[model samples]
Target: MDSVKLGLKENWKQFALLVIVNGFVGGMVGMERSIFPQFAEVEFGVASKTAILAFITAFGISKAVANYYTGKLANKFGRRTLLLFGWLLAIPVPFMLIYAPSWTFVIIANILLGLSQGLTWSSTVVMKIDLVGEKDRGFAMGLNEFAGYFAVGIVAFITGYVANSYGITPYPFYIGVFLSIVGFLLTLFWVKDTRDFVKKEGKNNKTVELKNVFLETTFKNKTLSSVTQAGLINNLNDGMIWGLLPMVLFSLNFDNENIGIITAIYPAVWGIGQLFTGKMSDHYSKKGMLFWGMLMQGIAILFIPYSSEFAVLAGLSAILGLGTALVYPTFLATIAQATSPQQRAESIGTFRLWRDLGYAFGAIISGVTADIFGVEYAILTIASLTIMSSLIIKFRMPVNIKTVRK
Candidate 1:
C-alpha cells in the first residue's frame, strides 16, 4: 500500500478487477431494464403507467440520495467499505423482486437496488479515478462505464430471453441473485482500497486548486455545472428510455424477445462505443463532444415513437446509444478533472446525485405524461427537454474551462 503508484498500467490488475466488479454491479440493475415494467403490468395487473414505472421512481430517488452520502462516507470510511456495504444492501433485492407478491414489493426492491447501485457504482468510479490518476481519466472512465453498461445490455438481453421462455417471475431475476453474491465476494476478496493512491498523487501534485466542492460541482463553477446538468438530462432521457421503451414496442405489437432486442441494442451500442469515445474526450474538446452527443440523443429519442419498423427503431436506438457513449464517460472524466483529489469523490457524488435524480424526474414526468396524453407525447416532450439541455451546454459553459491535472 505504501508503494502506491498512479496509472492504469501500474494498477491494471486492480483496475481490471474493479471493472469486472462494476460489471456485476451493472448486471444487478440490467436484469430489470428489459422486464420490470412489463412484469408490473402483466404479473401484478398494474394498469397505470405511473404505477408501472413506480420502481424506477423509487430507484432514482433512493440512488440520488445514496450517491450524495456514498461520497461523504467513502472519504470517512474508505472506498472498499462503501463498496462492500453497498453489495450487502443488494443482497435481498433479487429475492424481493423474484418473490414479490405486490407492486409495492417491487418498488421496495428497487429502493434497495438504487441504494446498492449508488454506493457500488460510485465507489468503483472513485476507485478507478484513484488508480488512474489524471493521465487517462477519460479512457479509464470509458472503460468503467463500458463494462458496467455493456453488462447491462447483456443481462437485459439475457433476461428478455428468459422472461420470454420462463415468464417474468422467477427466471429473469435469478440473474440478480447470482450477481449480488458474486459482486460481493469478488469485491471483498479481490479489490483493494485505492484511497492511498489518492494520497500519493496529492503529495506530488501541484495542479488542484480546491473550491466549495458541493456548491461548485453542483452549480457554482461554470464548466462543472454544465457537465452536471448535461449528466442530469442525459440520464433524464435515459430514464425515459428505461421506463418506456419496452412498453412502446409492446404497444406496437412487438413480442417480449423483440422488445428485449430493441432495448438491449441501445445500451449495447452505448456500452461498446465508449471504447473509443472516452479516449476521444481525452484528446478532443469535451464541450464539442457533449454538444453533439446531447443533440444526437435528442434527435434519436424524438424519432423513436414515429418509427414503426423494427429496423428503424433499432437504428434509432443504436444512434441514441452512440450519442450517450460520446458523453457518458466524458461527464465523469470532466468532473474528475475539474476538482482536487481530496474533493473528487464528493464532487462526483454531487454530480451523480443530480444525474441519477433525472431518473426519478424522467420516470415521474414521463409516467404522468403517458397517463395523460399517451406514451408518444410523453416521449416527444422528453426529447424536447433533451434538446434544450444541449443548448444549455452550448451557450452557458465556458469555451476554455481549466481542469486540474496531476
Candidate 2:
C-alpha cells in the first residue's frame, strides 16, 4: 500500500497501458460505426429506419445499465476484475457479428458489446483517475480519451475500407475479433487494480457528499446535474450522428470509401483535438467550455443537413468533433470535482448511465422523426435540442462552482 504513489508520473507505465487498452475498447465500437446501419438496410431487407436503429437502442440501454453497475461494484469486486471480465465477455462479439444469421443476432452482439464497453471503458476511466490523483487529472483524462476516440477513428476508417473493398458483413467484423483478443490479453496480463490509490486519495479528499449520488448526479445537485444533462444531450446528438449521419451521406450518393472518410472525420478530429482540449480543461472554466462546446456541436449539426458538397460536409463534421472534444474531458473533470472521492465511481457511473442512454434516446428520436418527417428535419430537431442543452449549462451551472475539495 505504501508503494502505491499517486500521480501520472508515478504510474506512467500502467497509465500508458490503460490508454492502449482503452484504444482497443474504442476500436471495438468503431467496427460498426461507419457501416452498421447501412449493413442493416443492405443485408437484412430492413427498411424502416427505426428497425435499422434497434441495434443502437439495444447497445445504449445495455451499456447504460452496465455502466451504473460497474461503478457500484468497482470497489467491491475490484476494478481489474471488471476490466478483465469485460474483455473476456467481448471476445465473442465479433464472431457473432461475422456469422449473424439475422438482425436478432446483430442486436444480441451489440448488447454484449455494450456491456463489455461499460465495464472495460468505465474501468479504465476510473483507474486512470485513481492513478493520476489531482494535479494533472484533466490532462490524464485527455490522453485516455484521445486514445479511445483516436482508435475509434482509425478502426472506423479501416473497417469502412474493408467494407468498401469486400462486403460489409464478415470481413469488417474480423477487426473486432482481433481487437477483442489483444485487449483481453493485455488486461489479463498487465492491467493492475487502482482501488488502493482511490483509498489513498479518498483519505485526504473533502468534496461534499451528495445525499444521494444517483439522484444528485441525475438531477438534484445544481452544477453536477447541469453537467450531467449536458453529457446526456451530448451523447444524444452523438447518437443521432452515429445512427443517421452515414445514411445521410449515402443519400448524397457518396461512395462507401467516401462515406467512411466523411464519417471518420468527426471522431478523428474529436480524438486528436482532445490531446490539447483535455489539458485546456485544467486551466479554463468548466462552465464556459461546456456551454460553448455544446453550442458548436448544435450549430455544426444544423449545417450538416444543409451541405451536400463533400468538403463542406467534412468541414462541418470536423467542427462537430471539435465541439465534442471541448466538452468530453471537461465533463468528466467537472463530475470528479463535484463529488466526494469515496463516491466518485458511483457518481460517474450514474452520469454515464444517463449519458450513454442518449444513444437509445437519440436512435429512437432521430429514427422516428426521420420516418415521419425527413432526414433534414430530424437533424434540425436534434440540433435544436443540443442548443437547448448548452443553454442549460449556461444558465444552470454556477460561474464559480463550489468544487474545491476541503
Candidate 3:
C-alpha cells in the first residue's frame, strides 16, 4: 500500500494530465447523446429515427476499425505519440458539426470522433495499467474512469444547457473542438511514454507484428476472453444508454436540462462509485465484483422503463452507474492480470475492439427497436440482454475469490 502511494505521488502530475485528457475525450464523445437526434432532424432534414441510426452506425464501424489499429500504432509509434495524434485528429470534429452542410457531413464528423475515441480513450486505459502496475491497478483504473465519466456527465449537462439557451444544436460540438485541441496539446507536452515499463519486464525484444497480434496472445488468454465477453455486454448497455436515453427522455417531454441530468447520472455515478469499487476489487474477487456489478446493472435497466418521474429516473440512472462502476475497472484489472506486460497493449486493444463493437451492435439493435417498438420497450429489451449477460459470466468465468497478499 505504501509503495502504491509512493508511485502515485511520484507520478501525480502525469496522472492528472491523463485524467484531464481522458475526461475531455469522454465528454466529447458523450456530448452528442442528448442533442444529435435533434441535430439530424433540424439541420439535415432527416427523420429523427433514421439520423440516430446513421450516427450510431458510423461511430460503431469507425471505432471498431480504429481499435484494431491503435494498439499496433501505439506499439510502433509509442503510446504518447499515438495519444497525441488521436487528440490532434479530434480537433476538427466540432468545427465540422457546427458548419455541416448536410447529414453526410455529420456522419463524417462521427467517423472522425470514433477514430479519436478508439485511439485516445483506449490508449489511456492501457497507459494507466502500464503506469500503476498490477497491485494498485484497480484504484488507478477507477480514478481514470471517474475522471472520464464525471466529465461526461458534467459536459452533457452543460452542453444541453448550451443547446437549449442558444438554440444552436452544434454548440456542444464546438466545445468538443476546444477540449480536444487542449487535450492534444497536453498529451504532446506532458504525457510520458510507457514503453519503458514493458522493457523492464524483459520482453521488449519481441517483435510487434500488427497483423497477427490480435489473433495470437490476446484471444487466447482465458481471463482476458472472459472479460472481453463481459466487456461486450457492459458496453452494449452503455451504447444503448448513450444512444437511446436522450430519445427516451425527449419522448417523455422532459426538458433538455432534465435529459442532461438523467444522462449525466449514469456515467457520474458509474465514475464516482468506482473510487470504492475499484479498491474493493483489488482486495477481493475480480470475477465476483464483475458478476455483482452486472447483476446490479441488469436490475437497474429493468427500472428505467418504470421510472417516469424525473427523480425516479435519476435514481435509476445512479443505480445503473453503480453497476457500471463495479464492472469496468474489474474487467480492466482482469485484462492486466491475465496478460504479460509485453502483450498488454495488444490485449487491451483487442479487448476494446470487441467492447466498442458492442457499441455498434447495441446502437443498431436499440435504435431499430426504439424506432419500431418505442424507446421504453427498447430499454426493457436491453435489460433482458443484460440479465442474460450476467448469468453467462457468473457461470462461465473464473471467480477469483482470493486476493493478492500484501
Candidate 4:
C-alpha cells in the first residue's frame, strides 16, 4: 500500500510550521529592504549608484548559485539539513551588518544573507509543495509567499521607524538577530522532511518526465523557458524598486519614516492580495493571469517616477503590489504543474535561479542607467522591458494544465 495525502487540511500542522519558518526567512530579508540603500550612501559615504547597489549585486549572484544547488541537493541531503544549514549561515549576518567597519563589510554580509535566503527559502518552498501535493499548489505557494512577504513588509516598516528614532546603524538590525535565532530554534525542533511526500506525489502525477531539466527549465522547452524569462523580468523590476524606490522617495523630500511606510505598502499589498489570486490560479487560465499581472506591473513602474506626492506614490506602490501578487505564486504553481514531481524541485530551483538573478541585473541596469541617463530613464527603460516580458508570455507560453493528487 502506498501512503499519500493531498490538500492543506490534511497537512495543516506541517504546512503551518513551514509558513512560520518562511515568515522568519522573509523577515531576515525585509530587515534591510527599507534602510540599506540609503544607509549605503549616508553612513558609508558611498555616492555612485553602482557602488551603492553593490550589496544587491553580491546577494543576487550568491543567492542564484545557492538556489541552483539547494534544488539539486534537497533530495540527496534532505530538506531539514538544508534548512538548518541556511540558518547557520544567517547567524553571523546581523552581527556583520550591525558592526561593519566599511561598505566592503556590508557587501560581504549581504553575500552571506544571500546564502541563507537561498537555502532556507528554497527548502521551505519545496517542502510546502511536497506537503500539499498537487490540488492546491497555487494556494499553497500563495500562502507561503504571503507569510514571508507580509513579514517583509512589517519588518521593513518597523526597521524604518527604528532607524528614524535611533539612527540607522546597529539598532535597525537588531530584529535580524531575533529572527535568525528564533527561526533556527523553530526549524531544529519542529520542521520535518517532506521528500517522502514528494515521492508519493510523483507516483500519482502522470506527466511526461523532463529530459535535461536544466535545459528545459532554462531555454530548450518553450513553456518552461517562457515562464523563466517572465520570472526574471518580474524580479528585475523588483530589484529596481529595492535600490531605486527609496532614492526616488528621498528625492521627493520624504523622511525615513515616510519612505518606510511607502515601501511597506508595496509588499503589504503584494502579500495580502495573493490570498485570493493564488486560488485563482487553480480555477483560471495561468497564461491570462501571468499576462495581465506583468502588464499591470509594467504600467505601474512606468508611472512611479512621475508621482512625487506621497499619496499618489503610495497608491502606485499598491498597484505594483497587486500586479506582483497576481503572478508571484502562480510562477511556482505553473512550474509545479508543468513538470513531473521527480523534476519539480529541480525545475523550480532553476526557475528561481534566473528569477533571482534579475535582482543583480535589475540593480546593475537601473543603477548604471540612473547614473548616466537620470533615474527616470532607468525607470522607463525597465518598464519597457517588463512590457516585452508580458508579450512573451502572451504569445509564447502554453496554457498550464491544472492537476490534483490521487
Q: Could you give the C-alpha RMSD of every candidate to the true structure, in order shown?
A: 1.3, 0.9, 3.9, 1.7
On TM-score, the candidate that comes out on top is: 2
Q: How would you encode candidate 1's per-residue C-alpha lDDT over 195-215 as one tens digit per residue? A: 898898878676566557788
Candidate 2 achieves a global lDDT of 0.91
- Runs with alpha carbons beyond 4 Å of true place in candidate 2: 404-406
Tell me the tens digit of each residue's lDDT in model 4 across 1-406. 1555766999899999999999999999899999987799878999888888889988988898899899999899999999999999998999999889999999999999999999999999999998988789899999999998899999999999999999998899999999999999999999989888987876657888876999989998777898899999998998899999999998888999999999999998999988888999878998898999999999999999789899999999999999999999999999998888888889999999999999999999999999999999999999999999999999898765543333
lDDT of 4 at 33: 91
Q: For candidate 4, what is the TM-score?
A: 0.97
Model 4 poorest ten-residue lDDT run: 397-406
Q: How close is every model to the real structure, measured as TM-score?
A: 0.98, 0.99, 0.91, 0.97
Query: Which scores greater on lDDT, model 2 or model 3?
Result: 2
Candidate 3 lands at a TM-score of 0.91
In the range 42-134, model 2's lDDT, one tens digit per residue, is 888888888888899999999999999999999899999999999988999999888889999989999999999999999999999999998
Candidate 1: the clashing residue pairs are none
- Candidate 3 stretches with Cα past 4 Å from truth are 1-6, 48-50, 202-220, 401-406
Candidate 2 or 1, higher TM-score: 2
Cα displacement (angstroms), candidate 4, residue 120, comes to 0.7
Candidate-wise lDDT, in order: 0.91, 0.91, 0.78, 0.91
